[model samples]
Target: MLTHAERKRGIAWGLMSLFGITLFVGAPIIALLSWDMETAQTRLFTAYTWRILRFTLWQAALSTALSVAFAIPVALALARRPRFPGRLWIIRLMALPMGLPVLIGALGLIGIWGRQGIVNSLLLKLGLDQPVSIYGLSGILLAHVFFNLPLAARLLLAALERLPAEYWLLSASLGMKPLSVFRFIEWPAAWRVIPGVAGLIFMLCATSFTLVLVLGGGPAATTLEVAIYQSLRFDFDPPRAIALAFLQIAVTALILIVIASFPAPDDTGSTAGRITRRFDGRTFSALFWDALVILLATTFLILPLASIVTAGFKASLWGLVTSTAFLHAARTSFAIALAAGLLTILTSLAIVAAREAIADMKRPGRAARGFSVLLSGTSYLVLLVPPVVLGTGWFLMLRPLGDVTRFAPALVAVINTLMALPFVMRVLTPAIETHRKRAGRLSASLGISGLSRLWRIDLPVLAKPLLTAFSFAMALSLGDLGAVALFGSNELTTLPWLVYSRLSSYRTNDADGLALILGVICLGLAILGTAGQREASRG
Candidate 1:
């Protein structure tokens, strides 16, 4: 039933996909295995390492619980409340934190609650003798909530949106009170997503290096990632670093196993059940609660961004623009991001094509089947191997590559593409499935295959998702600081690295300017990539 050309295309695609997936999953293990730890003391089973393991797990669990708990009611309110004039924009703006660099987001948090920050400024204005110290657990937890609340809201909102219109209509017909409607309709739908979203956020928080490193203030707030970096880069303790890296991996694997055991909530049904938009105008109590939630969420989201913009302008704009380091860093960041974006898109396409081919086979033989299984299993490796650990491996391996600094661009590109593959795969998987469902028969009947089928049928159907995936990958690549940190030299600095360096040196004003610029650049690229594909598909 298949031709030679189709088989060749599939093979090529599969090979490329294998490479992309392998780079992510294999790189980390390779790094871990290569780690040269010179010590019985440095072994992974050390008591000190075990103590950190316990603390990391504890924080991640608590943070995940708090993030999900806060997100539930907020997500419900947004879904059920009347769509005011700016609701769509409000929702879109809420997603900004996801796009923002972690360091920048942390900085924004600092600007609000730091010792000399706006909240403290206000407290002083109110005649308080001292500002609240926001440097330990309070800072870490608050920052985690700020970054994750919108994301959790988005995940839960999506679930709420999927409720069938029939559910809403029935609720209305029954004259269900708001609480009753929530109990009967929204909660059931949203509760399912809680575990997955919470787990994901927890994982992110746990793996977080820059956030904890910066906001953590000292030893009291140190996370496993920070500890690893401190051991490797600062303390120069390879045995401790390796042991810590393993500890992080073990903890992550355990958590992931727990998360995987819980089924992911359904994401499809309806964008919103056909409920009539009702404003709670008649009930003062309902109105007060609604306004309070909105106000609190909005303030938490907006004030930090506002502070960044405000600080950026207040800083010597002329000096910031004129700084050679700033310009060089920006150029380096853009160049690497572009290279990474292109590589990621190509690799992701190959992966998609390969997956489609195997899945298309009438009956894959054991050899073909084995390859498919290997490819499918690759994504999990990414979750297992943290970026810092991989970066450490590459740093060790590339010692002989000559001018590791010059190779920084290529190394960064590789790491960025790797970091972005999971997100790209997520975006493309559904789109690919939809395209196959819609065009599988038509293409097969028409005898179309390979590039011809892709160009004529799949491309049109996949344009939007492809663009979304590309944009997401690009944005992620631009914001990454992990691999770049290990690879960066005098000439190979990136905007994120520059931001980090500035923050490390306490050049807060310069960091703010660079952050604003970086955020805008990433946002613009994402918008352009996504919008361009959407328009093309429409045309």
Candidate 2:
């Protein structure tokens, strides 16, 4: 029942929001999709592109399988096992890799497994002549596993926890064998989450820029994103870069479709109320096994971070702090992050509102449904797009318009938000949906409207998710090197690009130091934002 003026205003706001975002993210979309199409047409039958595509899929598949395979048992143990001392902290620590930048994590891995790393150093002490190569596929696989195992574990653990206690009680009363219990109960619950997590990890690995670029070591190991960068920046092949971008989009879209097949855990309408139990002899073995598994995992994960810290401290500690480049990068990163965070929140709110309106349509005809579908699909297109390709498109388009660097930070922020939208929507949708369902009629009856409703009703209910989305967007923007690296000038470099530049020149110490500092800052902000959201939710 929106009046003519109101609807016109609403449409104006939405378009303005979209246009502002497009000024930042639109060119990237054109670049990625256009490149993909061009590649399909020109190199459609080329063996090299096909070979590259094959390797990309093959590695991602294997990596996803390996990560999920290892995570299954670990997740089950955490779910079934009693909460012992330090158990909760252990779980929190596992999520550390998610917050760590890819470059930082890669650096850590080198410290632990590099030719002259700890293991090789030990071997040297024993008079060994050979050293292991932590480069190429081996390095890529290890990094993917390190990053993904925790995600798979978290997803599976949540699923396992959702089973009603009565199922366990029945199994025990009937004296079910351990294997039988796992087959019937644990497997079914955990299997539900397997596809989602696996698909997600595969997509992540496939699109990975920093890790693959750093550790790939050669052409045989390059991913599509990395390939696009090489073609555009290093090789100066616009047509090839365009083609790679297109292929990358198609591949990403396929993966996204596969991921979409899995039912969202939030929509499943099941909650795991607490069910406590005593630890018995049989459960003790599982507990011990889990503890050992996580312990080894933790050690492997922590070593790299430790190396970064140690190395950073030993090399150029005081010099980095006083460096003009470092200070400028830090300031630029913070500014873009703040602007992107605010812009993302606004865009997300608009999209959410649009979706709600579409859903509320009494007669959601073909056109309405089609519009809804387009919006839903558009939300994910950013993820499938390569940053460098997009940057190239903008660079080409804006070259005639004069210097693009003047607005590069703002532009990059918008792209960063677009890249972050799917995740932000994922987090916010659940909280908002739950709140609206529970409080919709109450708010309407009270005649709440506009900003007042948002402040009074919506804000209280959606506070946690709002804070979560903001922090996530900010953190992601902080870590983004792909788009920023392409668009950045001396005055506009962000933290991730700065870290990469240092690492490229073999300035490992300075890179590690900056990485550690940035990681801490990001983590602290995320935690503070989450805590603030929680407090607001309670209030």
Candidate 3:
């Protein structure tokens, strides 16, 4: 029933997907295999390795616990008070950290919590004997909480919003107490989603590189990711780096498997008519507590962003704008982002198309379902292979062929594409699947196929999701520090690299200015992506 052209297109896309996965995921893994097993084994068993691994696990657990604990109250407050002033803006602001560069967020945290930060400044003015420091374990925890608290709050709030109206009505009719209502209703709903959220936050913190690298003041604060960087770039020990990379992958894979056991949080469902009429939290004390929670959450999320804007403007905006190095880095970042974004979108489309083609077959068998699963799962494989590990593996693979620095930019772009794959799939799959479901039979009846069918059907419907996915991919690549960190040199620097370089050399002003620029660009891309989604919804 399929036309020759359609069959050809499907085959081509399937092949393309295979090629991309092989090139990006397989190559580095193959490269890692080139190392001697005995050397890698020896490196893996050292006390230093075990210590770093333990620290990584400890910090991630603490961060996940703190983030989730703080988020519950804040999410409850947000859910209870849906009509509060600036509520929508606060929700949007919660997402800012998603698009904000890690280095920029770190800078903002330092500005507010560092030894000379406002809190410490106030303490000093009060004649306090000791100043606080935004370095080491505390700093790592603070940064992770700042980045993930909003995410957890948003997810929990969405979950709360999706609760049925009947539950609130039942509680109100029964005159249930606040404690009783939460025990009977909210706790059950939230418990289902917490594992997934916690797992994601833990993995993010565990694999944290940029924030830890900047704030980790000494060896005591180093994470597995930073250690891997040091092993390859500083120590020039390929075996040690390979061993660490393998350890990181194993730990991440185990976490993913655990997370898979939980019911995945559904973000795409309609919550429009689901707002429950709450009978709890009506007392003055309850109201005050909720208001206090919302205010504190808002302050925690917004103050660092405000600090970045103020510090950047006051310090070196003009000098940074006019500097040659800054311009080159910006250009490099832009090019890489553009290239990576396009590549991610194209590759995602191919894999998605192949899956659709499989589904469109007259009789999809076990093989078809398995292939579809493989296609979907390939995107997630990138999660297990951390960017640092991938970069290290590729470095080892390429070192013998030629100068690896020459290929750094391309490799960074490829790695960024891989990192963006999961996100791109999330955005595209739903749209593409909906389109195919709605129109596939009709297209088949009319014998529409290939470019004709695509142009007439798919493109018009998919334009918005495609654009949104591209913008998100670009934003992610633009702000990426991990992929570029291993390959960054004078000849191949990005804006993030420039910001980090300035920070390393103690050029705080320049770093602040560059951070601001990078943050603004990323924010713009995020806005662009969301704008398309908003328009699509309205249409």
lDDT of each: 0.76, 0.75, 0.88
**Which window of ten consecutive residues has the lowest lDDT sum in model 2?**
1-10
Pairs of residues clashing in candidate 3: none
Alpha-carbon RMSD of each model? 2.9, 3.3, 1.7
Model 1 regions lying over 4 Å from their true place = 19-28, 34-42, 168-179, 266-282, 400-406, 436-464, 533-539
> What TM-score does candidate 1 reach?
0.90
Global CA lDDT computed for model 3: 0.88
The prediction achieving the highest TM-score against the true structure is 3
By lDDT, the better pick of 1 and 3 is: 3
Worst 10 residues of 3 by lDDT: 267-276
State the lDDT of candidate 2 residue by residue for 1-539, as single tens digits.
33333334444555565555555557655644554465446854677778778878887988899899988877776776656686677677678888777777888888888886897788888898646667888888988988998888887887877777778777888888778888898898877778777888888888888888888889989887787777756776766766666688789878878888886543242365755452222666766887787677667667887887776677675787678988899889988888888877887777666656666656778876775566666667677665655676776556557877986876787777787888887887777777877877686677766678768888877877788889888888887788786666676788888888888888877887888777777887789768975665799
User: Top lDDT: which candidate number?
Assistant: 3
Q: Candidate 2 — which pairs collide? A: 35-242, 35-246, 36-246, 36-247
Q: Give the per-residue lDDT of model 1 (tens digit) for 414-521.
A: 777877877777788777877778777777788897778778887877877877887777788788887687666678888888888988888888888888777777
Tell me the TM-score of each prediction against the true structure: 0.90, 0.89, 0.97
After best superposition, candidate 2 residue 522: deviation in angstroms?
0.7
Per-residue alpha-carbon lDDT of model 3 for 364-467, expressed as tens digits?
Answer: 88987888788888888778899999999889888888989899999999899999999999999988888888888799899887789889988998988898
